[model samples]
Each structure stands twice: as C-alpha cells, then as structure tokens.
Target: MNSQARLLDKLCANIAPGKLEWIGLRSERRGEVVVIDQAEAVVGLGLVGDHRMKKTPGSARQVTLISSEYIEAICRHTGHSSIDPRLLRRNLMISGMNMNLLRYQRLQIGDVILETNALCHPCSRMDEALGKGGTAAMFGYGGLCAKVIQGGAFSVGDAVIRLPVIDSQERLFP
Candidate 1:
C-alpha cells in the first residue's frame, strides 16, 4: 500500500469508542419520537418498535445516529440554550464519538452490530422540530444512517465499538 492509503486507513480507523446515551422509537412517519431505555435490533430491519422496522430489505436508513457533540453544536448554531435529543429524531444519541467517522464502518453495541451507510441529512422539518435556522444549523452535521447487520438487544450506556475493516471486501462483527 502507498503512503496516502496507509494514512487514510489509519484516520478512518482512529475513532474512539463511545457510549449509547439515548434511544428513540418513532411511532410513524414524521411522528413524535419516544425515548426508550433499550430495544432489540433486527437484521435488515431496525429497532423493534421503531417505524423504520417496516423499511424494505437492506434499507440503509434503518437506523440513525447522532453525537452529543454535534447536538451541542447544533444548539449553539441555532442560538438555543439546549435542545432535547428526541426532537432531533435520530434513533440513537451517542456520546464521545464522531458520528461521521462511522460512515461505511461497522459498529458493535452489545450484541447488535450496525454498518453505517450514509449521512442522514437534516430534513426541512428541522425548522419545526428544532426552531428557525434549525435545518441550516444541522447542515453537514446531520449525523449518520446505518443498517442493522447482526441483531440482538442493545440499551443505553452500552459501549459502541467500531469493527476494524481488514480491507474493502470483508468486515467482522460481534
């Protein structure tokens, strides 16, 4: 491998483990997000009670995760003193992890494994959910979207660890 590839690989694999700070279940499309303590992750679906559970097979957006750091940043950008994570609509709120770094990488939380696939762009509803300038505040900081890989139970306070990729082809999960 070349020097550039080695540096890129090292950067991508440098994310530190984080803790699951919160979990939210969406009852339906664009509905209120209900905070929960724990839930089961189902492969190809999502959290058991979340609306995304009905998504098509291999749906990339089955799970959405945001960082506490980004949430605080969004609040600062929107001129808010504080914002409840539930209104942000992400399924999981993680602390001490850069959500963006998880893109295309697999994460293990408890017995559940998830592979982040894309950025979960902030929707126009952010204006309603967060307040004016909400969507703009979240631009480029909207967090990440993932699909369930290995299913199992996960809960708040669970340790979130990345599954190191050996190459572009295979990834190990636990």
Candidate 2:
C-alpha cells in the first residue's frame, strides 16, 4: 500500500474532461498531455499505441506513469520541493488508479469509449520539461499514456468507467 501521506495528499479520486477543461488529447501512437487551451490534447489519431511515439521503431510502449515513489524520490534526490504532476505535461493527472486495473478499460469523452492501446514512457522531452537529467529519473515513473480507442467530445466532470470486456487488475498499492 502507498504511504499514508501519499494517500492523504491525493487531489482527486478521478477526473473527467470538462466542457472547457483539458482532458488530455489522445490519438493512435502519439499523445501530448499538456495544457492546450484548457484542454490536455492527446494528439495523433487512428493508429495503435505503438504506431505513434516510437523512440526508435518497434518498442510498442507509449506513455507510462512515473511511480509515486520514483517521482517523490527524484524530487528529494534533486533537492527540489513542491512538484505538481499536472505541470509535468501529463494529459490527466490521476491518483489512486492502477495501470493493470485500467487495462482494457473503456475511456470516454462524452459517450465515446477510447479503446486504450498501451502505456507511455518518458523521453528527452521529460528532461526538458522537468529539469536537467530529469528524463532518466522519470523513466518508469512518468504516468501512463493511452490512445483514443474511441473518440468524441469530452469535458471535465464526465464519469470514467471500465469497459465490461476488460478485467479490473489488482490495485498496485492495495
């Protein structure tokens, strides 16, 4: 289980794309979870997760999350204080969600279900965004990324639920 401080400081149980809120835009392989006109646009459309952001060519892994421990440890190691996940350029800043549990889960923007393809990993952009040599630290720690299995208009406050076809994996910190 995650430490008590981790759970206690959580910002929200979950987030829905708002009418004018940024919900992280996702496409086939390429996705950017940064602030875009109040919307987190997961760019790229109609491709599989791997087809999009290939550091080389063949690695199917896309956007992945930096583990809580990894993130916190990096901050401590770097002598930095007060970091916000959202500011790190993630499409959606999440708490209490597990990558395995979300496997096959149907993400929605309105009523459309985005068939998620895979998780996104860190890159040099992370180092540029965070600080010097931050990318390496973000490896395996950056939050997961996904493609739009289904697409439509999504707004904040929309309910996020798993699809029936996918099994909810065991929670990591549970």
Candidate 3:
C-alpha cells in the first residue's frame, strides 16, 4: 500500500467507538416514530416492529442511523435552533463518533451486527418535516444506511462498535 493509504488506514482504525443514544421505529410510511428502549435486529430483515423490515425484505437500506453531531450540523445549516430525532425519522441515533469514517464497515451494536452500506440521503419529505430547506440542509448530513448481518437484541445506551474489514481504506473513498 502507498503512504496515503497507510495514513487513511490508521485514521479509520483509530476511531473511538460511539454509543447508540436512541432507537425508534415507524410502523408505516409517514407514521409516527415510537421511541423504544430496546429492539431485536432480524437477519435478512430489520428491527422486528419496523415496517421497513417488510418493505424491502433483506435490503441494504434496512436500517437508518443518524449521529447527533450531524443533526446539530443540519440544524445550523437550516438556520434552526435544533431538530428532533423523530423529525429526522432515522431508526438509530448515535453519538460520540464520526459515522462518515465508518462507512462500508460492519458495525456491531451490543449483540446485533450491521453492515454499513451507504448514506441515508435526505428525502423530499424533509422539506415538509423540517421546513422548506430541510432537504438541502440534510444533503450530506442525513446519516447512514445499513443491512443486518447478525441478528440479536440491542438497546439504548449500547455501544456502537465498528467492525472493520481488510482494505477498508480503499472502500472508504469509493
């Protein structure tokens, strides 16, 4: 590997694991998000009660995660004092680490394992929920999309640990 790759590998590997601050689910599209203290992650599915589990059935976008850090940034970008996690509509709300650095990784939260696949881009609904420029404000701060790899139970306040793979630095960029 080249020097730059070595540097990136070190940086990515050195991340301080984050914490799962909150968990929520919506039974149906446009449904109200119900905050939960615990949840069971189902392999080839999603959180047991979440409608998205059945929506795509083993899809990579099964879980949506947002960092409190990004939400704060989104608030600044939108000129809002603050935005609620319920308004963000993501399943997991994490804190204390940079989710962007952990993309394309397999993340382990308590006993459940999830493969970080892609960005959870802001949808048009953001415009309605967060006001006019919500979508634009969340463009790059919308958080992450992941698929369940190992099914198990997880809870609020659990640790969000990134399970790194070989050559992660390569995937980190592309």
TM-score of 3: 0.90
Instruction: Report the number of backbone clashes for model 3.
Output: 0
- Candidate 3 minimal-lDDT segment of 10 residues: 165-174
User: Which residue ranges in model 2 land beyond 4 Å of their true spot?
Assistant: 1-79, 84-87, 166-174
Q: Over the stretch 1-174, how does candidate 3's per-residue lDDT look in tens digits?
A: 567545655777878789999999999988999999999999989998998998978788899999999999998988889888999999999999887776777789989998887999999999999899899999999999998889999999999887665653335444
Alpha carbon lDDT of residue 33, candidate 2?
A: 38
Residue-level lDDT tens digits of model 1 in 120-172? 99999999988888999999888998989899999999999987766664532
Q: Predicted candidate 3: what Cα RMSD to the true structure? A: 2.6
Positional deviation of 119 in candidate 2, in angstroms? 2.2
- What is the C-alpha local distance difference test score of each model? 0.85, 0.44, 0.87
Q: Residue 60 in model 3: shift from native, Å?
A: 0.8
Error of 2 at 37 (Å): 7.8
Q: What is the TM-score of each candidate against the true structure?
A: 0.90, 0.50, 0.90
Cα lDDT, model 3, residue 79: 88
After the best TM-score superposition of candidate 2, give how far the Cα of residue 17 lies from its true spot, in angstroms: 14
- Highest-lDDT candidate: 3
